[model samples]
Target: MLDLAWRPRAHLDRESIAIHLGLERKAPQAALDAMRRIDDAIERVRTFPDSGGRVRLDALRRTEYRTVLANPYTVYYRFDEKTLTVYRILHQCQNIDTYALVDLPR
Candidate 1:
């Protein structure tokens, strides 16, 4: 298995989701469940790096951008021989191509 790494935006995104669900929506249990699901998706990706579906964005087509769905959210990542780098964790309703792909290293 490749080593796992998280980009800063990925961390912030996860934290923001937790805050929004737990504090803003007053759904602390839901927040925890969401977090667990995200973690589970990450683990699944770690075990099978190519298991995620390839992202279908024109600009990202040349690169191996992939996503693992976690119900209402998605985990976006790119993997090399030695590492799997998480780029972002975003809500399913968001325009991921516009939001997550920006500022990512090609």
Candidate 2:
């Protein structure tokens, strides 16, 4: 089975969990819980890369990229024949077009 690798942006994505949690009035543990869920989802992605929805990008010519939602956040990933690359994690409400992820490494 292929392993899933997180791109640099994915690391920033993970940080967003704490950012969101900090913005909320909820307990600090809630951020930890969200991180745990994202970790679990990443594991699942390693086993099933296509578990995410096929993302259609106008800026890009292909539909190879996909996204999986983890509650208020969405995980964007790309898969080549041999590996899965997690590109970014963004809040669901964010305007995805602003990210310009079409240049992501395949």
Candidate 3:
């Protein structure tokens, strides 16, 4: 099985979604559904690394990130041979070009 590692930003993204949808919007069920979708997408990526669209960042020299969509959310991840690192989870409205990849430990 491929290893899964999550960056801090990804965790924050999930938390933000839960708060915005469940607490702020008062839609617990929808929040749950969204989380489930994100989880499922992550599973798919872990099982099949190439499942997402490959995103090549000019700034990152050695790593290539892939993007997977879970409806309104976009999951950014990178596979470094043995481990899959989930870099960020962003809402669809966010500017994708602003993301800067940093070296993550395996």
Candidate 4:
């Protein structure tokens, strides 16, 4: 399995999602479940790096982005021989355009 690396934005995204679910929506258990699901998706990615569906970005066609769903959220990442780097964790409702993934490493 490749080593895992999380971008700072990805961490922030996760925290934001948890906060929104737990504090804003008053759904602590749902937040916890979402976190668990996200973790499970990450583990799946670690074990099978190519399991995620490819994401197409017009601006960066040369760079491949992949995604794994965690119910209402999605985990976006890229992987190489030695590492799998998670770039973002976003809500399913969000518009996932190039701008939303601007923080991804080139």
Which pairs of residues collide in model 2? none
TM-score of every model versus the real structure: 0.91, 0.78, 0.84, 0.90
* Candidate 4, position 64, lDDT: 80
The residue ranges of model 3 lying beyond 4 angstroms of the native Cα positions read 56-63, 100-106
Q: For candidate 1, write residues 1-106 as lDDT tens digits.
A: 7899998889889999999999999999999999999999999998899999998888777888899999999899999999999998888888866555555553
- Which candidate, 2 or 3, would have the higher lDDT against the true structure? 3
Query: How good is model 3 by TM-score?
Result: 0.84
Each candidate: RMSD to true structure? 2.3, 3.2, 2.9, 2.3
Could you tell me which 10 consecutive residues in candidate 2 have the lowest summed lDDT?
97-106
Highest TM-score, which number? Answer: 1
Give lDDT: candidate 4, residue 77.
95
Candidate 4: which stretches are off by over 4 Å?
Answer: 104-106
Full ranking by lDDT: 4, 1, 3, 2
> Can you write out model 4's per-residue Cα lDDT over 1-106, one digit (the tens) per residue?
8899998889899999899999999999999999999999999999998999888666656678899999988999999999999999988898787776666453
lDDT score, candidate 2: 0.74
lDDT of 2 by residue, 1-106 (tens): 5667787778877886777785665657888877877777767777788787887667543657788877777788888777888888777887777354644554
Clashes of each: 0, 0, 0, 0
lDDT of 3 by residue, 45-76 (tens): 88899889876555543557799999889899
Please give the lDDT score at residue 83 for candidate 1. 93
